[model samples]
Target: MKLRSYLYIAFTGTLIATTFSCTKLNEEFRGELEEADAGNIDPAALLINAYSSLNTPYQQEQRWVLQEISTDAAMAPTRGGDWDDNGMHRAIHLHTWNADNGYMNNTFVSLGTAIYNATNVLRFNPSNQQIAEARFIRALTMFDMLDLYGVVPIREGESLEDFRIAPEVLQPEAAIDYIVKELNEIITDLPNNGPTAAYVANKNAARTLLMKVYLNKGTFINRQSPTFAAEDMNQVITLANEITNSAKYTLSVAGKYFDNFAPDNDTKSTENIFTLFNKNGERGGNVDRTWNTVAHYNMRPGGWNGWCTLSDYYDKFAEGDERRGIYYDYAADTTSNRSKNFKRQNVGFFAGQQYNWTTNQPLMARNPSTAPLVFTREVTIRTSGATLETAGIRPVKYAFDYAVTGQRNNDWVVFRYADVLLMQAEAMLRGGTGTAAEALDLVNDIRVNRGVTLFTALTLDNLLDERARELYWEGWRRQDLIRFGKFLEAWQEKAADPDPKTLVYPIPSQQIAVNPNLVQNSGY
Candidate 1:
């Protein structure tokens, strides 16, 4: 894959200053520079802005919290005074979030910025490749925005004020149609899958995006009814076939499975279809948050000790699955910077008494637990008051970059072939042309290779569990739960009787405030 350098290009100072002031003055600002007037501005840089906007959503783990933390797969426990972002984290887990919830609002803004930047690229008379890549990024952004918010604000040509007035909102069907049309029109212009095609969108990447949109079209259109259309499922199957038949990807297994997330994953993993390229400290990136959220402060290259996997979800993995990669190791003494004192754990769930590697003694937790920082299997979904440091089993799913400061060099995988295969299996089982036996085999292939026990039969519930085990912390949990008709089901500390409106996030309060045409999702 081409090493995508994260480049920051600054527009004119006057333009930026005016734009910020316009936001405060309640006036719309537009990037209206024409191709001729662009002077020395590189058209590719504008598209880079669109790609950079991805960092905005995934940067601070906002999407992960929305997708994984809100679902039963994971949670950001409020450890006492820490991680209590004004109850935002807790609200998501409990499905009690309102329109003003900070994280939801941030997500709304981040995706909107992606649309704006992509539109900027389209405004210029760029080459076909630039146009396709910009539209692909725009389509991907809109798909997620529509999926989560149930409405997409398409920023039409060079005029934000006019566009906002009676902004055309693309609801589920309209959004999917729009995205599918965009991908289909541009797939031929995209680059083919190869070593030079990792970070950028390729034909397979577009197909994968189309597959995802088609697979979840039913849920996006009507979460309440959510009847999988045969045509959509067939589209999913067809697209999956294109990706698999290309033979450009494979399922990473056992010893090499972790390579998909390690610091050098971009070079080692053959499975990543679309991923965010990151070089530590060059431009701020997100791989750090994956490990930082779970690693103990006492461990070398310490973590925030905030987020952890829910125990019930942890149990989904079979006993000897290599994917269940958590194990206790030596922890470092922060006071003296020595590593021989306490045991550190990574990935999956951590529990029981943590031991010091030096004297094999119990180390005290910061939260003053009676036991030696024993992380428990059970945790309150809503941690309102004091939450102990060792309350839940920390999940360190991605390989941590202990070598870097602040940011990690690991490339974040957005779509992998394994996920593509599973999507095909899902399409087959969900009323597509393929047989159930074939679907089970597709899933078992992943399971056996990952060194996990295989299922004799595949139930809808079983498939959901398999997805959780295989793709946990990769940001597919919420989507999977909703499609499987289980998003509103009660689990761990969440309420089963959640409102159907909870399926889609409320159109952020600020968005509705700015654009009256934007309607809030049903039950906000």
Candidate 2:
């Protein structure tokens, strides 16, 4: 296989020129390649491009916006005229979104592009390791497509000649089976968990994704009322135990829980199972958006002052829970170069009055110039008046990366060991091979590590709240809500949605226009 054979020149001219290492894999290719020069093409570069595709959907706006903003865990309120992008954010939170929603359309296209890129790697004669990695990437993207949209368009065969052919659509049931099969087949070829394994496709990464698939198999099959089969629960438990038994990961201590998301989290984190690799001057997504999305405009980094968690969700954590928030002086800390010039800012949730860390002066809200910048618990979808910019609690999941003016070094987490434990516990509680006492112990283990009180007893509701407290703003809230049967329930700015069709987003209209085989999901 040669580079020119697979490059979709007309459609991916920019991607080929900038992203792929094949310099001549663009419109300039005029069949001038010598047969001997074919050996010069690096298959690893193509694999890296496949891996790079994850940055857009996972780290940046499209998928993260759909996953987080549509749930009770976070919302992008229309603060006067600032974040009101023609009601895109409001439609998501209020469950009034349609197929025309730009976020939904972009997310669908981005995931499809990722899948196409990953599959393109197979057309070239790559090594076994590269083949396994590319297949894993394809499976992961396809899993997301199946979760968000009910159908997945699968390109058949490892032939670029079939690029124009309409892909075979896999419905929910078949999609789940296909993902499970792919992961199982490639798990052994992937690298073992080690220093750099978190950023690459590895055995534990495959195991963690498998655990997610099995635990949510019921939810993926039926979002309205999920049924956890005993066998599927056992699969979840087994996969979690395999990862735990590897001894490569453990929960970060109570004081260092935020380290998992720090700028140098690539080395500092002990709990990350898999993450998207990023560096200051590298080709990666804008992870700084995690903080810039919510921080006050007057803060050290001068954020956009958008999106926040609801008060109802904020009340889930106790006062002493370190996951709630903790003050950290980024300027004083002598750590990575990424934290240079950063003023003091809290790591977790931010509420009440904020201040300039260096000057020790109260920060003022932009709306009311004289009033202090005090974040309040009350917020509305269409915000106005004095509280326009001050309402809603802010969350800073990733530590501030103030050194670089461009892409930050914080590696965006895709799976963490804490989530592994929670999944195991939930599986046990939902009729897996463990007892209720064992499930409670698993939940308490994480609680104790996070400086929170242990529960004397555990229920599904308590487990859901615990997940919210621990995994808030991490982009799993919507899926968790649907799995636990609380997605349609009203909370804060949203009211109960009478239609269950809102559970799965509609297949993007653009997709249906391009691929006639695609049928739009029921509602929209």
Off by over 4 Å in 2: 1-40, 158-160, 329-345
Residue 231 CA displacement from its true place in model 2, Å: 0.6
Cα lDDT computed for each candidate against the true fold: 0.74, 0.80
Best by lDDT: 2
Q: How far is candidate 2 from the true structure (C-alpha RMSD, Å)?
A: 5.1
Q: Candidate 1, clashing residue pairs?
A: 1-195, 80-387, 331-342, 490-496
Q: Candidate 1, which segments miss by more than 4 Å at Cα?
A: 10-36, 158-166, 195-197, 326-346, 353-363, 367-371, 382-387
* Candidate 2 lDDT over residue span 195-236, tens digit each: 344887789889989999998888998899899999999999
